[model samples]
Target chain A: MEKMPKWADVILIPAISILLAAIISGLVLLATGKDPLNALAIMFDGAVGSSRAWGYTLYYATNFIFTGLAVAVAFHARMFNIGGEGQALLGGVGVAVACLYIPWPHWTLALLGAIVLSGIFGAFWAAIPAFLQAKRGSHIVITTIMFNFIAYSLINHLLVNVMKPAGVMEPATASFPEAAHLPNFHDILGLVGIDFAMDAPANIAFFVALLACWFLWALIWRTRIGYQIRQFGESESAARYAGVSPTKIIMISMILSGMFAGMMSINNVMGEAERLVLNSAEGAGFIGIAVALMGRNHPVGIVLAAILFGFLYQGGTQLSIQAQIPKEMVVVIQSLVILFTGALDHMVRSPVERIFLALRRKEA
Target chain B: MDFLLLLDTSVLGTTIRMATPLLLACLAGLFSERAGIFDIGLEGKMLLSAFLAAAVAYTSGNVWIGLLAGIAGSLMLSGIHGLASITFRGNQLISGVAINFFASGITVVAAQSWFGQGGRTPQISGAARFDPIIWPGALTRIRDLLQANLSTKIYSQIISGHAIIVYIALLAVPLAWWILYRTRFGLRLRAVGENPAAVDTAGISVIRLRFGAIMIAGVLCGIAGAYMSTALQAGFVREMSAGRGYIALAALIFAKWRPWQALGATLLFGYLQALALRPDIIEKAIGVKVQVQLLDALPYILTVVILAGFVGKAIPPRAGGEPYVKER
Candidate 1:
């Protein structure tokens, strides 16, 4: 084989890794007496085969995008926000309280109340750990993970007793009223021969997430605070000497990260599900870490990574139905992406840097 | 209505039983993290081990062998983590995430294929279980006294009969404490986590030390899983670790990565769990009718509250995540 060009390693590494993973999955399928091509085809078909499937896929992608952005933002601050689940949980609680308990005559007011409350709740949930890290010097990883558990049990209790609709079998609150339901635009579009469930609820939230990403990009690359955060991330001592308040930065980043997560849940509570439910976001928050890593902590990169995950998620379900495979194959694929990305970090960096340097030299 | 009588036994039992798995997991985390390896994947590993312990016990008709199998399985996964993170200089968080996702997928698939069990394994037989060893006279009296009553009765009722694993878990605490504080190995392990280069200069192998710690964590996690499936519940269910591994991790953190401190944190969490489950007793004890939901959230709420308050200055080892690269 021709020796791979040094510059090409940047792209080749992941491309080769993904191909290797697909081959490995293929082999696993064959070993289990399944056709690989058929599985792949079904996965694609299921994800984008029909209008309804595409609609649902869009809805799923929308949620993933927001949470993925949340994770990405924290990663930029060099803080791992694993409490995305907890933050989202509180967000849902906020939305539920706003919808069920708040006195609202107008639909727009109710919607605004729910969104604002969700963000506040999420920020509050995350603020505890942020406070610990800022003031007490607690490790972000463990503290955030612990907080996720607290959120789960706390929500479970509240759902079972206080918030739950009586006679409900599972731990879920009452559905919001019709006025509170965010319209699935796809369903409305159905009257004009354009219908899909996947992206039905795709609305202003997507734009908001995109806008948030842009804002984060500008905040990270442009502003003084962004420079201080990067400086702190690089060397805490130096950043402190430079007059940046490390504690304040830690708290602010965590709260901001968490607020973004709160907005992510608005898709479910205000848009798709229209009610608070247990295990909401499932593990999307965790998946956001993978997105952040794949995106290389770049805002635009996160958008692409989120979309890729969305495709895998949609396609994986299709493959499962078609090939009688477990949909968890998608999870395996995701784990592989993270594994490859992490393992190939060196490859992605030096080669790309070298390429840029060589191009600059040639131009000069 | 003699409600107090019923309340005490249930509270005591729930506290003891609920605390057992958390204790085991916390101890496991304490050991691993003390040596400076992040063990966020404990829940996934424990779930895998628990499922396998139940499966092997159900199949081979030997709980001892099943327990061993679980320990071995966890060790293998831990070894992978050690190799990937320690030897290869891979990211710790990524490796943990991989181990968790891999364990979850592989265990569920294996269970689905082997036992044709959907979401859970079939309940195992009595022989596979760890039965309590009941003793005579004083032990019997102690058992009755400790049985869920809220009187100021302090006796040795705890030794009446619990599965052998329960005693082992309780015993492991002191053993871990001893291993951590008294031994030369413990000092070296701490040294390795704090500063691997210095430890290396001191002629100790950081790689071997960290690997050994990770493996020990795996073995303890295996026991924790075994207790969860056979002793606590009769069968293995999907996600049975149910984030308990993570809780153990929390306990370890709450204790600040110390073996001895973990005992207090785990028990506190257990007490909270017990309180949640036995809300009637809690209500009466506290003299307030707390909504059961709030009661259930006691452990989590307490975790946030306590962690927020005390974890303000719990500094980890200086070279915790940085991989040791030997100079040429």
Candidate 2:
């Protein structure tokens, strides 16, 4: 088999796939009687037009980063953690409990406490499916999907019966204490004699996501457990030959994946909403898969992919508001991107590899 | 315990009504999974069909024409899935996910564009929808129980007064079973899922067989979608399928991909849904208050328990989710 040049494999393949998806999307817009170029301009303006726009984009990107890293971690162990939706929902439970109940005098202290609680909650939720996959021969895919529905009901139940303020009809818990509110980028920048976007939800969690990317890089490449996980993902038979226990690797990797998914609540629930609302996690859990796949399941790659998707999401909303394109059309475009970059990846790669191989053969 | 009191004819009737979509969707899933294809896009296909069915039924004022339109709409998605996963040899799961997103987005946008009613078609009613076919009282009676009492009526009414699609959904199980076990095509279909390479080696067109199976799935999903719009509801709502496809897939897994078992699993899940729908009646019958959220979550909880091997192992077809590539 011919190998693609490193640059093509790392950069060019995704660029062309995305460009193809964009061209097709443009055709779709034109078919619908919309101006594609004007739509693109509006999206660009909405996503990066001002610091406030960047704040919104970065806020969305932060949620994607956590979930994307969650997906990337599991992909290392050859596991698909579709349960991130469920895990993230459960993590909100953890954050809500900590914020609403804890008598912390400071937001920083509350953030630390919430982080540990959310991680534990998410990990515990993931462990059940992990146990089923390892010990009971259940396909992780079906179980995780089932768990997502279960999570929604569970959270709704809690909000309605257990957490809702008395006489409140809506399915939402009380807002967090003022001390529990996470400091946004504006606040942090203000401390350092700088200015930033006001009233924006792009909070300290963005920095946390950057830290997570670096942490994921070190964990997957530098640690012994990471080596074991990669080995197990690459080949179960070969890993067994290397004396690695499949059960241990599966459980640890999935728990870690769930933890990252759980930590996303810090960005969404803790930073953005400041309340544990129904549907807070949204579809970021599912979007994480595309992010991981497009990034080739690497931390750096996932951050980049997450930001790109963030741009799409923010920009797509602008198209709806400004250009009269349906917001759902963005979903169509995003799915097309996923279709090309993730599913039909070889469509771009194989052709590029062939050309590279032909040129090398001619040179030889 | 007054468990028997909870099993009222009304509950059973609701169960039958709710089970129609599940039974149809799972049967659809059974065909796709049995043909070495992993179809998680059943929800999307059903949603698309539901919209088209309602839209056409409203326009044409004929339920049958709407049904055909629904089937055609669903088949279009199935064809796309078949083309991507089989012809393109792409990742089956990714294709399935993409199909789901594509169907969801397309349906809403198209519905909003065409109807301009905020992503819904006009409400269809009476003859435009599937009205219940009530059997004659005398025909539903036993020879000795001709007395028109409540008990006799309960016994007979359970089998009567349902939309035609409900009966079709019930009849589909036996028909699917016969077509699966008692036919030559069924044998080849099962063989292809287990070992497509072996089927390919025998000079059979694996692509055609798989494509045919997926199309059969599309038809079933179309009926399922049509049932939702024309029989259960007046018109299509956005996301009317609402994860029933995923639930049906879980039911399919619990059924171990067998037709009869699929019927039983779907009915069980449907009964759980029915119980959730009538929480007041259930609480009164049982003389105990039940958590509505827990009731809503019960089927999923049962699915997880079953998937955890508490019940037994549910094995998938060996070649399922693997795109069959022709060897050079």
Candidate 3:
């Protein structure tokens, strides 16, 4: 079999898979008696039709970037960190404690403090599973999944029994101080004499996500430790022969993975909600898996993938609300995208490879 | 402390009841993992089957039909997993994740279209739901056989009065042991996991064996789901299986992929569920505060501890997640 060109491998394969997904999703809509064109139009309008929608889309994308990076970083170590949901949950707790306890005078200071705290929290949550996978024979997938459940229960316990103020029936904790509430894009843009949506949750967290993309790119490609992680991920025996410690690589990879996941809470907890709430991490954790897979586990690929998913999420919600499509149908579309790009990838690859091979054979 | 309440037959009954779903799912995972396919969509399969069983049973007014439909639904999904992973040689984990999302979305959409009650099936009643087996007039028989002792009768009640599926689930452990260890197919299955090439050399088709294992896993998961909707409860609800599938996978790991060990692990988890259901019992008995959520988290925490403590023993099958390829 002939190896495909890098451009095709990086761009064309995902594009074809996604196109196939869109076609199949259209068929699914048609089968349900909904107009595919109408659904498509509604989705487009909902996602990027206006500045407000873009705000929601970017806000959602911000969360996905953190989680997607979490999965991608762990992927470098060949570790499928399925515990991002749990790690992100734990990150929320860190944000809650930091925001609720420390009274920062400015939003900038609070953001910095939350970053450190969330990194520590996310890293701590991921460290246990990483440590177990390194030291014990436990599979990371299984352990991380189990940890997701534990994280949910822990967060639930804290919200219901510990954090809720007295006489409040609601399970969420009290709102954070004003300093902790990060400024949204509208607020920032307003300062520069530009009009923007006021209530949109899109905040400085999106910039942080972009920074993370750069950080990951540098960490994976430019640094010696990054080289060691890649080597360990590619082949443990090769790394071990080169005197790299397996335990250290595994632990560090997972901790860094967790830190990224935890930082996601800064977007939801501090940026938008301005308080700790149950399920603030939402399904962004699982969506991260899809993001990582579809992005081919690359930082640039992940950023683009995050934006695409963000569009889908916002658009699907709009379709469901306006077009009366079932809310779960969006999930079905998400599944199809991953199923084609990640699971059934060879379906597109082998045919392309065969064509390329045939062309070469013809030339010969 | 009301020790008696804590030890009540009703509590034990609830534990056994709750354990039924986990037990079936654990067995399902054992079969799949033992054949070298790491099937993580057990929850999805269970959820699908649960929905089908309840929907069918409610519509047909026949619990048996519901069970069959549920099994078929689950098998269909497992077949997809096999096609993707075994045939196309895709990543089993990703395929499993995809199918899970598929099941979650499709079921809710189908449910709403079919029943029109949000994402729930109509509650089943009469002959559609499984009731206690009763074991051929046990009240009179027990009185005559046991001289009407309270403890003896209560003990029988704890052990008996379960739906027929519960007994089937319990009996399956030994059956799983027989097929996995004693049968020729069992030997081939084990060999396939350890080294698929060796199985191929021995004139056994690795694809067929693995596909069969995946199908069997599906059937078992279907039963697990059907039991929940058609037996334990009367209808299906969205995300009804919750994370019982993951709990089962954890139990399977805790057991190290042994059938009998799977039973022990599942029952232990079931006990934890029971404790979670009634945290006050623990609080009263131990004279300390008990967090139900923490109790719910025990399986995950214990699995970690066990993994760390017994690292060597917990290793999965050598080729569990790798897609088997013929010699090239």
Candidate 4:
């Protein structure tokens, strides 16, 4: 067998896999007694048709972006940190505690403090498993999964008792102060001459998330730590022989990965809602894994992959309401992405890359 | 103190019941893993079996048949995983995860379409549920001494009071141990996991043995799920198995993959879970001061701590993840 070019092997296979997935999904729609085109149009409209719909879609993307980055960060070190859900959940606890207990004279500083504290708490949550893996040689996947369950119980306990709002029956903590709420650009625009129907709870966090993605892309592709992490991923023993402590690298990689997930809590606590509710982050952490895998664990690839998922999530909800298709189809789609992406190798990558290259050549 | 006495009974009962499913799952993991197949999809298999078993019990009004159906369903699912991983040489972890997702979607669709229910199946009648198998009139005295206020059926449902199934599950420990340590078949299975090429050279078919082990794991997981939904609760809810199957895998590792050791490890986890769920015990023991939810977190906390400490020396099968291809 001939060895394919390195770049082609990495890039093209996943692209073809996505195309094949799209075709398979279309076939699935046919089998499910639905018109593929109509369903697609409805999904697109729901995700990005109007200004209000577009705002919601963008807001959804913001959370995905951070989570995708979290998964990507760990992937760079050849570590599959499936514990993004736990890290994100624990981070939300930090943000919730800050909003409820931290006394700040100004809303902006308080909100900023809460977000920063979220990163610290998330890093701490991840540190436990990282320490186990680094010091004791425990597998991160199983340990991280165990931590996710622990976080679930711990968060549930805190919400129902210590952090809960007084006189509220719901198992949720107190709402954030008005000053701590995220600033929605469209909401701000409505006050001026621009009269667009933008959704409530939409915010500028999406832009921040987009910028963060670009920054991550630069970090991985340009920086020294990025190279070291990638080198470690390629071969831990070789990297160790080259003087990098496997323990330190694993610890730092997990902490950095956790910080990305922690930022996702901000989108939920500050942007999506004002209070910390039970399972509010909802499997975004797991979905982030799918996104990372679909993106081939590349920073830019993860960003694009996150957006695609965001579209599906935003669109699926709308389609369920309008087209009468089940909203849970989004979950199915997510699963399909993981299923196909998990299996592919050189077979899927080459043809897609050659096609893209041909298109670029024509454009040039 | 009155509270402390109540807490003691609650703890004992909770431990016995909780340990039931965990023990079964740990045993299932031991079967497949010892034979050289990584069975991460135990979670999915258990969930599929739980849903099917409950739905069938409610529909047919025969809990025994439902139990059989659950085991059959899980075995079929596990067979598919075995084919994919063992026969096709696919990645075990990914295949297991796919099975989990597929099981979830299939269960939800089947539940909604067949029973016309949303996420939960119709609750089975008392006649259709697994009642306790009491050992005649004299055994009733032991129940009182143990403060087992619940019916003998409930005790046997998940624990000792179970029909032939409970005894069989316990019996499986030594049986699996014999297969792993005493038999040439066991040697081949372990060799397949450690190094398949060597096993191939020894003229033993690694593929066939791994497939057999995988099937055994699946059947055991199915029975465990059936025990939960039909025997224990007489109903099934969405994601009812939760992640206990994976936890069972953890237990197997914690026990160092020894069948007898797995039983002890599984019992510890099962007890922790029971202690967390029984609120009556918590209130009595701690003077109603602490939150019950905190207790629920105990099992997971202990799992992380135990695995980190004890699993440090766990040496996974050498060729565990590598897809075996015959040298052409």
Q: Candidates' DockQ values? A: 0.36, 0.60, 0.67, 0.37
Whose lDDT is higher: candidate 2's or candidate 3's? 3
- Contacts from the true interface found in each model, as a fraction, amount to 0.38, 0.65, 0.75, 0.33
Model 3, residue B174: what's the lDDT? 99
Q: Which digits, one per residue and each the tens of the lDDT, describe model 3 over residues A1-364? A: 4376788888988998989888988887777678989998998898999889999999999999999999999989889898999999999988988899998999898998999898899999999988888877677887898889889889999999999989999999999988787889998889999888887889999999999999999999999999999999999999999999999999999999999999999998989998998888978888898899889888889999999999988898898789877778867877887788877888778888778778877988
Candidate numbers sorted by lDDT from highest down: 3, 2, 4, 1
- Please give each candidate's TM-score: 0.86, 0.94, 0.95, 0.87
Give the clash total for candidate 2.
0
lDDT of 4 by residue, B1-328 (tens): 3654543543665565566777788888877876667777898899888988888888888888888889998998787677667765665676676677667766765565466567579888775677756554323355564655455434433444444555666787888789888998787877887888888887788788788878888888998998888776769988888678878888888888788988888878887777777766566666775566667677777888888886658876677666678778
Clashes by residue pair, model 4: A12-A349, A13-A348, A13-A349, B3-B284, B132-B152, B132-B153, B156-B161, B156-B162
**lDDT for residue B245 in candidate 4, whole number 0-100:** 86
lDDT of 1 at A200: 46
Off by over 4 Å in 1: A1-13, A16-37, A97-114, A157-204, A319-324, A327-329, A343-364, B1-10, B136-157, B181-183, B310-315
RMSD to the hidden true structure, all candidates: 4.6, 2.9, 2.6, 4.4
Tens digits of per-residue lDDT for model 1, B163-195: 788778889988988888889998888888787
lDDT of 2 by residue, A165-234 (tens): 9998888888998999888888888999878889767899898889989989999999999999999999
Candidate 4 or 2, higher DockQ: 2
Please give the range of 10 consecutive residues that has the lowest summed lDDT in model 3 chain B: B136-145
**lDDT value, residue B45 of candidate 1:** 73
Clashes of 1: 16
